[model samples]
Structure formats: structure tokens, C-alpha cells
Target: RVIEITLTSPMPDFLRLLAQPEMGIFLDGSGAGPMVRSDESDGQPLLLTPLPPEARGFPAREQWQSRARQVAVSAMPANSAVDAFAAGEVDLVLNGRLSNLPLADTGPLTRGTIRLDAALGVFGLVVRSDDGFLAEPLNRQALSLAVDRSNLLQPFNVGGWQSTSWIVPRELANGAAAQGERWPNLSFEQRRDIARQRVAAWERAEGEELVLRIGLPDGPGSDTLFTQLAGNFTQVGITAVRAGLREGAELELHDRLARFYSPRWFLNQFHCRLELGLCSEEADDLVEQSIVESDAQLKAQFLATAHNQLIDSEIFIPLGAPVRWSLVRGNITGFEENRWGLHPLFPLSQPPT
Candidate 1:
């Protein structure tokens, strides 16, 4: 009924994390490893929900299996899933953002069916391109300062959404966070004025007009955020334009959930080799040191130093917490709220108590 794991290094929070929901040891009786698939349904009409693509390899326990016999699984885009859930076609829809937010005036979405998870991870724009005005670190920092992060999620109309300028969420940093906010004392407008000055300096020195090509998704949230960013850039004496994710945009949002709640995990996401674009080698060195350092305080120091180094380099323009949401029918059971943003399919299929 239990399993034991021995770590070569100290992982103080390992036991705490293991005790959380959807966390456990499993016996891969199939021996497929990462190639594993969903639970087998014995020819039942009800559909079983799906785990995230990365989680397909996890074995399905009997308790997590659907109460309905031999159910199926459906995968589709968020919008289509919303439409399907609104009708009686699908039993459950997961990971739909508020951009396709069906009108609250009607439908199951208006009821208590909407579920939002406060996922902890990097949800912000990274400097994807090294060319253009972004070539300079100060210019990148200017862009970070110019954007009104507080308003980026206005399109969703959701509350309690945490907007932050730091890569690691402060509360989750343990003792690793050094300073709280990047600009705690400065007002949003004050931050913009400083950014405008920096941008003006770049324009005057280079004699080249500033342009920021931001890569974004094709959705209402992206539109609102881009428009606000463009306006902010304009006020800061730079022009902002939207670019496709692959269209050589200098900046793009990287919304992701942390596999493990560690500052190192958050810091590794932006490493140069990770393909996250323009990162500090010095910061990478610190992260590497933290990996081998046996001293706990020394490790925390390294992480804190790396975090502040990234902030100073303006490698990523922090937005807010990554959004993970789903519309579950009122009758649905076994869907529990968790920070990891993972909802097992079998649990959603369990009949309502």
C-alpha cells in the first residue's frame, strides 16, 4: 500500500509534496514508461476525461477510474471543448482559459461549473529574439517596466489573479527570495516614466526608432494584453506590434506550470540551452552551482542570487500566475482544487455523491 524513495541529495519538501492530491507511487505493470496511454474502458457509453499530454504515461489506478463502465476520451481545442460542454455532447472539459469565456448570461459555464486553479509557475514574456532594440539588456528591462502587468488579465474578468514582476513567486520561495518587489516603491506611472527615459536614451544614441515585436496567442487575452503593451510602448517612445510565435518576435509569453515547486525549477525554465531565448550565462552558472552545493543556506543563497540576476537582466517580463481552468458539470464529483493544475480523468468520471 506504500512505496519508498531514497534521494541522494536533500529534498526537505519531498514528503510534503508526495502527500498531496494526485501524487503517489505507481507500479507501471505495463512497463511502457513514457509511452503509456489512458485507462481502459470496458465498452461504456460515458466518456472518461483526459490527463494532460505530458501525463499520458502515468498508470491509472482503479479508484481514479470512471464509475461509468468502458468510457471514452475526447481531446479538442478550448473553444470547441466549450461548445461541446455547453451542449450535452461531452461530460467534462478541462483547461479552458477565460478568453473563450462563454457568455455568463446562459449555459453551464455561468453556473458553478467554472473551476480555476492557482497554478504556480512562469507565466510571462521572455526575450525570444536577441536582435532589434532588445539586443540591449536595458532595452529589455525597459519593456518589462513599460507594460502595465496589472491590466494584462482584464480581458478575463477573473479576480485574485496574482500579478508579479519576479520570476519566482515570493511566498513559495522559502528562504531563497532576497528582495520582495522589483520596484516596490515606484508607482506604475513612475515605472513607465523611467522606462520612457531609458527608451528615449536608446533612440537618441542609436538614432533608430524603437519597435517591439511581441509574439502572442490568437485569443481575446492576447489581444487585450498586446493592445495594452503597444500603448505602453507608445507612451515610452517605442512602437509595439504583434508577431506569430515563430515570426521572429523579440518577446513572447511563456505560460507554464512548475513540475516541482522549487525555485531551481523556475530558474531552469529560462536557461539558454532550454530554448527559452536570451538568458544570462552568469545566472546559469549560479543555478549550476546550486545544483552541486551541499550547504542548504549556500544553495538558497545561490538561488536568490540567480533570481535577482535575472530580474536585473530583464530576461523575462513577468505577467502573473499561469491560468488553468475547466468547466465541470454541477453533477461532477472527484474534481478537487489543487495548485498543480492537474485533474485526473478517472476522478472526473466518478459519479456524483
Candidate 2:
């Protein structure tokens, strides 16, 4: 009566041994929250069980149980986990990147098993605000216009993926308001021309070629994206070099934005005091206001203002909404897509009668 399942990385792999295949449940250790070993409140179906020393695999293993089911968890790498799911070795795939799965409409595997969740993350580029060449907002805006986001994301072909201009995805609280943009109707060619002009001005002021290194994390779509970005920057007369992540890389790719919820979490990333990556004093003030204001409407208004200020400043170029996809066996039930991109395991992992 084991219910077997596979989950995304950082969860643990040996989980299959503790719980029977049909009785398996997977919990995201990174996001277990209140469900992490709590024996309070409503009688949640799952039971938190301690794994024996041998069951600890390499270091440790955590398990959960219910009358009908038992779950073991382990960290499985993204590619291997997706491969396992496709091979029918696992009943479910939780939190796999869209770019890593075989999701083309015509692919045999994607007939109806792929699920999309509206995740709360931003995939974008970040430039250090203190860099002399990047300090000007116009230079940043030029970089944003150089790459057409829709074209860049077209290869992924994810259904729920949306091109975003602001760091905060629109579905988040009060994030629906348009955060503003530098140019509205300019064609790619027009935008390129403008970017070239801005770069020329920057070069004349600094007396050096406008060269910048862009660091990107290694992943399925990252290499292609880097090549695409380099081409776009070339068209705009800026020398964009694709590099691995380093401290002084002028521009860098951030595929996963703020992982947790809350508008404050999203806005605080760019504040000067935090020193996360980019920094903005004006945006920092707005974030502080949003944090302290007691009134709900005022809080929303303050966030909207902060978002607009950041967007206007062009510190980040939001590439597209973060990609979150899963592959489930046809018979799996009780699955629901939510904006937060969380799927509680207890209800779904109940053993069949």
C-alpha cells in the first residue's frame, strides 16, 4: 500500500525506502513552515515519524505518516528527477523547471500530464548600482530595450509564462497596477537605435568602449539565453560578455527571484541598506513606508509607489515570469494550481482504499 512519489531537489532521495510506494508523501524541507513537525491545531492527516539511524541514508532523513500512507523524502537533482518521472519510476514530479521537461505540445509525454503553477518569483538581470558606467538610469533602460523578452522566452513555450516589465509579478498583492516603462511602442529596431545612441553617449563620457560582463547560473535554458542576450547587446553597440557569476560582473542573471511571499519581500531586495545586489535610496524609503503603515490601502499604495520608482529607475530588467511546472501521472488526484506554487502533500498522498 505504498504510494511512490518523486520531488524536486533539496528534499532527499532515499525517501522511497521509508514509505511504501503507494503510501509515499513528499514534503519540501525548504518550505515545510507550520507543517514542520507540528502536532497542534486540526488533526492534519499526516504523521511526523522519526527515521531510524540506518534509514538516515547519508546524513539524515525525515518522514511523515498517516493511517493509509507513509512518506520518505530525499534530495533529487532536477534532471534525474524529471527523467525518473518520464520513465514511470515516480508517480509525481513536484516543482520541476519548465525548461527541463519535455513539454512541447506534440511531445507524447505532454498529452495531459503537465501542470502549471503561478509561482511567485522573478527572472531578471541585476546590475550593481554603484558601478560607474551603470549608475545612470538611461544606460540601464537601453539594456532593457536591447533584448525582446517575448522572443527570448519563446523557446521555453510554457503556457502560464508571461513577459514581465517589473520585478514583482502582477498576481501578487497590489502588484496588478502598471509599474511604468521607459518606452511603450518602439519597435525592436527603434529600441536598438535608441540603445546605440545611449551607449555612444556613455562611451564619449567615459572615453572607453561600453563593455559589460553578464553572469548567469548554469541550467537548461541559460546557455541559449546568454547567446541571445549577447546578440541583442551587439546590435545595440554594447559589448556584452557572458560570464560565470562573479562579484564584479556588471550584469547577472537571476532566474529565481524572492522565493517567499509578501510585497515587502520583493521590494526590499533592491534597497540600499540591505546591500543585496542593486540599491536605490528612493525605493528604500517607499519600502520602509509600506512596512510601517497600519492602513491596508495605504500599504498597497506605498508598495505600488515603490514598484513604480524601481521600474522607472531601470535597475532590473524582468525577463519573464519564473517557470514552474510539474508532471503527474494521469490517475493522481486532489491536485490544484495556485498562485503561490505550493502543493501540500498530506491530502494528495492519502493511500487508496
TM-score (all chains, Cα) for each model: 0.81, 0.72
What lDDT tens digits, residue by residue, belong to model 1 across residues 272-315? 89887888888899988988789989998898888888888888
Report per-prediction Cα RMSD to one decimal: 5.8, 11.0
> Roughly what TM-score does model 1 have, to 2 decimal places?
0.81
Per-residue C-alpha lDDT of model 2 across residues 20-100, encoded as one tens digit per residue: 333345555432222234343452333444334344344433443332244433347766666666777777777766445
CA-lDDT, candidates in order? 0.73, 0.67
Candidate 2 ranges beyond 4 A from true positions: 1-67, 98-108, 170-182, 204-207, 257-262
